[model samples]
Target chain A: MVSNTNELSHEAFLYLIRQSGIDLDTGHDKELFDYVKSVLSSLDPLRSIDVGSTEPPMMFIPAQEDV
Target chain B: MTDVNLCYASVRALSELVSKKQVSPVEIIEAHLQRISETEPVLNSFITLLADEAQEAARRAEAMINRGNHLGPLHGIPVGLKDLFNTGGVKTTSGSRIFDNYVPIEDCTVASKFRAAGAILIGKLNMHQFAYGPTGENPDYGHMHNPWDPEKIAGGSSGGSGSAAASGQCTITMGSDTGGSVRIPSSFCGIVGLKPTYGLVSRNGLTPLSWCLDHPGPMVRTVEDAALTMNVISGFDPKDVASARVNIPDYTENLNKSIQGLRVGIVKEFFDAPLDAEVESIVRKAISHIESMGAEIHEVSMSMFEQSQAISGTILMCEAAAYHRELLKDHAEELYAPVRLRLESGLLITAADYLKAQQARALFNTSVNALYQTVDVLVGPSQPITAPTLLAQSVEINGTRVGTTAAVTQYSRPYNITGTPAITVPCGFSASGMPVGLQIAGKAFDESTVLQVAHAYESTTDWHLKHPDIAS
Candidate 1:
């Protein structure tokens, strides 16, 4: 599923780039289109590992020195 | 003098000349202002230049020195601040139209530090919309171009800081790195950017991207210069609880420290990836240079690097949504398309998913601490590729096309998750003449070691001395 999902496919990944709002003429640049797709697939936050409910979400706290 | 005056004459050099009465602050500020004007049209690095105020401040510094009054290490120095930082009574647009006219009643801690050190604020540098993007392409505020090649990008969310520092607009510029914003642009623009260990600098009055991942640090042409600037801004802040209570070391104190037999580990998983040949070559050279300097190199692996990126992204998106939830709903149509899409998509992430990411964070941080026991530093290519053309929305590296965002940021985000420090310095340029950066990452709260290694690389190479000759 990880390898075959359109979310993982080159084309759907390209769509993610388009959705991200970078200005590009998708018609002319096949390389960019494919590349954007590849990059997006890699960025899927859902794929890498299993998360548990007990852990606190990582974040930058403006005032939390110990965080 | 023409070339030397352009840049690489340290803040110390400029301040000393001013101190000796050999050069007036007014003259230094005017020179930088003229250079900014000369380069802005081509590089678009500075969104705003406070020519009037800078000149006025310079005049005062000159008057003070004449009366035998000295402020500090930054006296009479010219530097730039990212527009995202709050400046009392000045519009801090954050490169977004939403805050176009927004002004604050107080200056950000970092900005005030610069002001108090007798540093003259040249003006505000542009950034990615709300410091969200890595490529620094601001749909609202026009993109800041690379000084070396206008068609190529200056890396962002600290794009302006990177471009301005590289283009000689300032001796140093303040930038915030949330997932490599500071270091990424510094790498692409061919300068040194220090992403201090989280909490080393105060976040008060600095705009938030993700509540936990944002780090404010200095970008300069050299590691020594970064150390010089960092010494002033880093330390405990009552306004920022995240500011560490630990003593802020004299950053320059370790500049010439020997790394003889220091354990430097190269993350094979990271460098072994499909990185651009040019980037890999320069990175290998940097590692070799470090090894030659009496450091031992070992191959280290952590499967959690990818995991860290995801967890960091999840936390970033979820936390970002928390900040923008209301604003995004009301101003959905107003957001620059990419930022809106990112913030909006973040809403789809379930609470379970966010918690999962967080739990994984504790596991990953523990694993990283284990890796640190085996090595004092981890090094890698800052970007998978050099600066892509401004026209390129994505680039191909190692034969795989990757989107601009992921390719630029993948290597830099993990350190953010582990709350460790990372710095990027120009290693070399590609064949097409674009620069590549080597990132030196150290153990938690071990910024002193990272700075030492970076400063040593800088001492051995002239890459830091090179700048864009914008005009023929």
Candidate 2:
């Protein structure tokens, strides 16, 4: 099940990881899931900000002269 | 001078000795090698020691100087590169066992530049595995031990660079910062680390952690040594697609210039975060010290600064995951546990969230740049606390407990988000004797002013003059 909201629910996250073809060790599954969940949770505040049509920041600009 | 003194001498001091033929390159290399041997047992700073290559390079440098063919300040100086940099025919593990046998056919641009400048390659320093974690906890190799206190972390992902420079195992070292890898270690190890403006230094051959956020920089014992290193490394590289074509200036030319009437801003949000009592006191005192030097200090607010981790983390994870997609799929189990989990987390970040984070980053950059319009630089504590003990999973700040990684990278992520030049200089020491760093950040690509401000503060204080007593 794909996540409808910005935050991924535990079931949705597990589904996505399962789809990713990454096998989580049974013994460490709980530990691994919690770690990823914490990382996602930290970004929760970003969803509330109003970006106002601003373009995403440029990562790099291509040089005219080829290397 | 004794071997101990020779090992700790700054590049500027040793450059003069080399130029005047008072000290041969061979003697300098020997001193550093001897120091490395003594400190390696405790520091665990280097994964690959290049004593033979360093001596050979020193001999070549001596012969060239004998023929009156000097290469300049960096000539005959010793430098250690983080293992991420690809060196021809030499292993570049990047702090992981997976790449233990990987060797490159050609030298990375940075390594080649240093070689051309006649800097001896001392060794390849260790780091956090794949430059993922903030603490120097690498299970594949021994954890990087602090020169000040072996029980404490040296700070990562540039942990080994920090330990080596502070312990006098190398005169100068290179560190790459995605968030605060360079400055964090510089703070914990009591040294100078400078992350030049994004695109100021090329990332041509560095192992990528995050393509957009990764920045190669200098971690050294003094500000002038950083400037000297920058002179050789900073320039437009046609090969690097992200390399800026802006005119490069002599980074050392503005040193010793008066910082009178210079405006320095203190971000209110920086202090609003969780902070240690001693760290807050030391950073504020450093600000007052700058004011005493005729620099105007102002309290500024950038509300978006608090959201920096979200913005930087999102982009970093997506890019890092995209780059390492195959590696994770094919060899996930080979990675360290924490690093493996972090990389897997990146796979879960939706494209929408990644883009949303970048949009927020655009706003964050706008807010920070506006502050520079009012103030020449932003000043704050480099890390909220000093180096944490390796045995502890988290540290207590005030009455609250916070994870070590979160606390260390809090202040560092903002500068990386802005892609501006930021530097960390030792301001003072905590009650327990760990060093505190005062960060000075300037407008994008304006490293000259950043260096000027840091150099001014460094020259007026005795903080940078102190070294770890690891040898004793």
Candidate 3:
């Protein structure tokens, strides 16, 4: 639901990290936030795709009984 | 046999000597041990060297050979495993502080296969921390250096395997390729690395980077050696849920076969991206050489090729994040900076985003497979640039600044996403004397064709014969 790529403020980024159960006070918090933003930005094209009804690459198949 | 250069000898050659009783396994093992002692200080390729156990195994191999018993081509050969693989009693650190004392009670299927083939396990090779990064830089166990030039990176997560294989520390080494771990190191270290089709080799005991993407395969000095090793490792293992139920072919049997009528596809998208001039030239020349040998060369296009890195990154980040969630929660500070950041970033990827990436993966796989219907195999540069300096964060490709990680995995990662078999062979060297690799990928489960093409090119070129000056 990230509507704006540049709108991800430091405060919001830190909130997301905190919500994910990671420590926010760690020295690497900002660095981790920046990296996460970068990865999410790069995946924009894939995120925008309307993969309606298409299954994921790996799917579980149920075993059928012999006739 | 004493005068024979055991350091650069292929598994085939060494096995022949051992089978004929002309060379003792003990002597071969001792020579490698001596060479390791000399080169390991500079390369730092091994995290643990099981000298005593390897020597004892060599003694047993010698006795067996003397009694007219031979296991196979891998018999009496020294092999190294990337530390990510479980080694039973030996420590399987996975280049992380968390598992520094971790040891398994059972050998991975691949390790068991090597043992059954009578190969001596020399030690566990160092790797990128938890196979999370591609640079092979482990803060815990020093960074693995390229044998050709210590200043350059030994392309990693399987970096140590490539260094050991190239430097002749081991006759063959097993490397797990997730996002080009095997091929990147192969290209950088100037050796042959094969990333078999997903599920072709079992991943039962290897540390998981991305369960869906990880592939276990061989890294060796020559294409034939890779093929020989592949023959022993590829099979259906019931223990691995992802293991493919397919007929495993004798990969070495067709290595000498003619590739005259084969159709080789030149992926236009591969070269359209930013690439180093020398790497492009050398790879083009190698492709032309393949055409000169009577293979039909065609230009094939796939637009999705450019988006592979993104798709791969999304998938790997989410999968790896999920696997390491508990560890990150418990020991976040223990991880290397880059890996910890990467794993943390994965926690932010939404489930919808992960699924979308998988959807894109399916589309990409289908498109690439459709291209394969017209071409027997695809050929491209293994990496866009030669090995970057160990300290470099980014490299300039064709006058543009590109991140080192992106450039290193560009050509190889797409194959991993598609879950196809790809092999990197030394095609030529860069202007600075570092090695360049040419990649040949085949249809799913069609490693034989890929090996055939690589073997034909390797037999004609002298690239594989060149070794680093690390021995002295």
The DockQ values of the predictions, listed in order, are 0.19, 0.65, 0.63
| Better-scoring candidate (lDDT), 1 or 3 | 3
Clashing pairs in 3: none
Tell me each candidate's i-RMS in Å. Answer: 6.5, 1.7, 1.8
Highest-TM-score candidate: 3
Order by DockQ, highest first? 2, 3, 1
Model 1 per-residue lDDT tens digits across residues B1-472: 2335735577777767777778788888888988887888887777778899999999999999999898866888888989989998878988888888898899999999988899988889999888878888887779888888888889899999998999888988999988899998899999999999888888999889887889998998888788888889988898986778888889889999898999998987787655998778888988999999999999999778766667788778777867777777567667776776677556545576667677877878778889889999988888899888874767898888877776788888888887789999998999989999999999867789999999888898899888888862
Highest DockQ: which candidate?
Answer: 2
In model 2 chain B, which range of ten residues has the least summed lDDT? B1-10
Estimate how well candidate 3 is docked, as a DockQ score. 0.63
Runs of candidate 1 with Cα error greater than 4 angstroms are: A1-54, A57-67, B1-6
Badly placed stretches (over 4 Å) of model 3 are A48-52, A63-67
Return the TM-score for candidate 3, rounded to 2 decimals: 0.98
Error of 2 at B152 (Å): 0.4
Ranking by TM-score: 3, 2, 1
Q: What tens-digit string does per-residue lDDT give for candidate 2 at B193-213?
A: 999898999999899999889
RMSD of 1: 5.3
Which should have the higher TM-score, number 1 or number 3?
Answer: 3
